[model samples]
Target: MAPLMNRSFTTANTPGIVHIADSAAKRINSINAKAASNPPQAFRITVDSGGCHGYQYVMGLTKEINPAEDVVFEKDGAKVVVDKVSLDLCTGSTLEFVEELIGSSFQVVGNPKAETSCGCKISFNVN
Candidate 1:
């Protein structure tokens, strides 16, 4: 069978998988292209406390990957690596590039396990 390549698919077909938006994949690919580093950096997602909603989501670019501690998901040549700990809270969500009036940024939306979230989008309380 041919492999899935340079494509995006819906979550309905893959339970427990965090979907990546095309905008996000493009953004990551653009960033990595500029960096031009080996082992190519991947977008990293982490969850931590200290925010209006008690917990918060953090995203950044990283070249280091601890296989034992992280899970990497890729789409359209872009990669997203999440710590196992955070994945439990954000599974079934979508990683997206959001452009708004205030500013544009990457965010996680439609988190099935999140009970509540702040207007800023980064702050949240997991269910």
Candidate 2:
């Protein structure tokens, strides 16, 4: 896929893996530095139902990984893991860290499967 917002991203050779942009990796490293955990943390992404746009993108930090259920993507020293079920909804998408006058957050960008996204850009609908 082409670069988005001038940010470059890399994905695993395996399919169903979401790509992480360089900007997003830098932001993830920043967040991990402030986390009050001993072993640091990794970003976790999950897609859940019930947003105004039908599916909501949820992001958080974690220190544990259930290898059988999660796929981890890494860049620099930052890592992001998406559960298997969520991967199905996010295949071929790029997760970007964006800052605007409103605020800054992780967002799912360039999702070919998404039909429409909410104003907040945290929720979306797929065909």
Candidate 3:
């Protein structure tokens, strides 16, 4: 009998991973500077189902690391971790931190999995 070949299915032409932007790096550095006194274990980037468009980007600090999660990018001691499932949807995506008159937040841009995004830029339509 012949051995079977492994087959894999992936979304768009997105890469496995990517890093944050230069501006995001600066902001992360600043955050690390302040977190120096009370540093977190890692920074987590996640996509949850719920938003104006259909999906929303969620980010926060994490002290406990999940064995199943994958570390995609890290800079200036700031690390970003995404679960296998989320990684599949965020491949070739860039994580950026934007500060505006309204507020400052972490965002996932250039997502190959995204089919469309809301006007607020807080949500997306994933394929």
- For this target, which candidate reaches the highest TM-score against the unseen true structure? 1
Candidate order, lDDT descending:
1, 2, 3
Query: Tens-digit lDDT track for model 1 on 1-127?
Result: 1245565432222234578899999999988888887767899989888799887898999989887677778897788888778887788899999988999999999998889999898998976
In model 2, which regions exceed 4 Å deviation?
A: 1-14
Which pairs clash in model 2?
Answer: none
Residue 83 lDDT, candidate 3, scale 0-100 = 70
Error of 1 at 113 (Å): 0.9
* Candidate 1 clashes between residue pairs 3 or more apart in a chain or in different chains: none
Models 1 onward score TM values of 0.86, 0.84, 0.75
Which is the winner by lDDT between candidate 1 and candidate 2?
A: 1
* Lowest lDDT block of 10, candidate 3: 1-10
Can you write out model 2's per-residue Cα lDDT over 1-127, one digit (the tens) per residue? Answer: 2223333333444458677888899998887777655666888989999789999999988989887788877777677888888888888888899988888888988887889999988899999
For lDDT, the strongest prediction is 1
Task: Tell me the whole-model lDDT of each prediction, alpha carbons only.
Answer: 0.81, 0.80, 0.68
Model 2 TM-score, all chains together: 0.84
